[model samples]
Target: MRTDSEIKSDILEELAWQPNVDETEIGVVVEDGTVMLTGVLDDYRKKVAAEDAVKNVRGVKALVGDIQVKYGANYQKTDLEISKAIVKAFEWNTAVPEDEISVEVRDGWVNLSGEVDWAYQKDAAKRVAENIIGVKWINNAITIKQSIQPADVKEQINKAFLRSADIEANAITVEATEGLVKLFGTVHSIAEKKAAEDAAYLSPGVHIVINELEVID
Candidate 1:
């Protein structure tokens, strides 16, 4: 196992490598493979980028992000303006169902709520909100509609894992209870672990994915 200091060093390097993240503004603390990030950023995207970078590090078992997004005076906008922008963004994005989702902005934080047919649509709505300027953070409460029974959810996810070269389908076991899916097994890296969870979310009726896959790197 890598030491905490080593994990911190890799996280710092990863943050520096990401174009959207400012390494100097972020402070990284690592203990027992868990990382806590603290900083203030001008854009919410940078904060998200920082978290993603940290997660990509090999030794990171968990992450706690406390980054604050504070816009400059010139970049500040009223809540109404932010909401309008998000709505417009959703409308323009083909993947997001603009009519089905509701947007509420408070002090630059956006709260999205509604139901969509697919997990991809729900994710697309959040992605649209993230790109809008002055969006400090996003609470994606959008849910996926159960268009079909989840009786075959586990089978479908297992097939998806088999189709992907990144995943070791035989090594991972999938469990489904209604719309909730759980993954248990071992993966070679953090990226593979994430891939398994993403595959689980793509199943027709899956609403939640509990990724308990251990990284054995």
Candidate 2:
């Protein structure tokens, strides 16, 4: 446990160490482990960097950043650039389903909605949206679809299993039904078990992976 003063000091130290931030330019207020940052930054990236610096601190309960940026006046143009940046980021990412996801911008706020096959894709979508300039906030309304075909699912699971060196292909039992893959087998360690599951997840049509594989001690 850390005292409020200790947490405040830690927050300030972290912010000072961040790239392009001057310690003298930043002011911090602490009340019961919640930090409020007040300062002026040269650009939007520094504004974001300042907030992120405090966010990753170990004892930080919450962050309220009131940092003003010189670029705030050009927010409308910034918003358009941010929207374009987010679109380009997703278009090149293989894990993201760009066709299923739609990015809408309103007053520098981004709203993302659509269906994706995995939880990782949902997280990735949010990250891309946040990196865009002029983005005051993001609304993530992505849904996950767990329905897929059995034969296609099975083939994908088999390919994933065979890709691993530790998985004894002959002993592995994989069954896919309605986009859900159920694995029943023995693996040497927990790492192998996780790898096997991840491999199945990367398959194009897989919606859910259920690992029933036993780990040997």
Candidate 3:
């Protein structure tokens, strides 16, 4: 097992490798593979980039983001403007149902709440929120409501995990209730755990995937 100091050094190196993030402004501290990010960034996108960069590090178990979004003078937007921008942006996306999603902005943080039939649609809405320039943060509260028989959901997800090249099928377990699926097991990496969850979401009638897959690497 790698020491916390080794993990911290790797996270810093990962941060430096990310082109979008200003590594000098960020601080990282690790304890038993848990990483805490501090300091400030110019945009919400960069903050996200920093987190994404760190997650790819081998020893990182979990992340706590304490990084602040320090909006530059040119990037500031009123709540109404932010709401309007996000709404307009979503309108242009083919995968996202513009009318089905509602945008609420308070203090430059965007809140997206709506219902969509597919998990991908909910994810599309969140991507739109994340790319907007003035967005300090995003709360993707979009819910999925699909018409699928609950019994078939588990079988379908199990088959998918078996098919996926990245995931170890036997190590993971799946449970389904209505449209919600709960995953429990251990995986080799964060990427594999995400792949298992993606497989669960691909199964029809799945609205929420409660991923309890632990990364054992």
Candidate 4:
């Protein structure tokens, strides 16, 4: 097991290496295996980048990001302007169903609520919103339209794991109840853990994925 200090050092180094994040503006605290980040950045994307950097570090069990996004005067936008921008962004993205999603902005935070046929579409909406300037944060409440529960949902996900190069199918177990899927196992890295969760989400009728996979590396 890696010590907290060792984990902290690696997190700092990872943050510095990420081009989108300014490492000096952030504070890192590690206790046990959880890391807490506190800082302020000019863009919401930077905050996300910082969080991703920490998660990629080995030995990090969890993260608490208290990073604040305070846009400068030049980057500030009215709620109406933000709303318009989000609408335009959704239209440009082919993956998102523009008409099916609703957008509301308040104090630079975008709230997305609607229904989509696929998890990727819901994720696409949030991804588009995250890149828009002046967006402080996003609440992706867009839900996947549930269909008939597949009797072999768990088996289908297991097959997907076998086909994917990023996942080790043997190390993971899949459980499905109704439309919810639970993953329990061990992965060699954080990336692999995420891959396992994403594969589960891709399975039809999987409304929620509970990833309890431990990163063993």
Q: Which has the greatest lDDT? A: 4
Evaluate model 1: give its lDDT. Answer: 0.87
Query: Considering only N, C-alpha and C atoms within 3 Å, which residue pairs clash in candidate 4?
Result: none
lDDT of 4 by residue, 1-217 (tens): 8999999999999999998888999999999878999988999889888988887888887788899999999988899998998899999999999999999998898999988877788888998999888999899998777775656788889999999999999999888888888999898767688888888877767778899998775
Error of 1 at 183 (Å): 1.7
In candidate 1, the residue pairs with backbone N, CA or C atoms under 3 Å apart (3 or more residues apart, or in different chains) clash, namely: none
Error of 1 at 127 (Å): 1.1
Q: Which ranges in model 1 have alpha carbons more than 4 Å from their true place?
A: none
Residue-level lDDT of model 3, residues 119-172, one tens digit each, is 778888888888888888888888888788877889989998989898899999
Candidate 2 structure quality by residue, lDDT tens digits, 1-217: 5677887787778877987777678898887657788887655567767777775665655568787754456544555677788889999888778888988887666899998877568767887766666766678887667655778778867876777785666567898776667888876544466667767776655666788876543
RMSD after CA superposition, every candidate:
1.4, 9.6, 1.5, 1.5
- TM-score, cand. 2: 0.56
TM-score of 3: 0.93
The whole-model lDDT of each prediction reads 0.87, 0.72, 0.86, 0.88
Deviation in angstroms for 124 in model 3?
0.8
lDDT of 1 at 191: 73
Model 2 residue 60 CA deviation (Å) reads 2.1
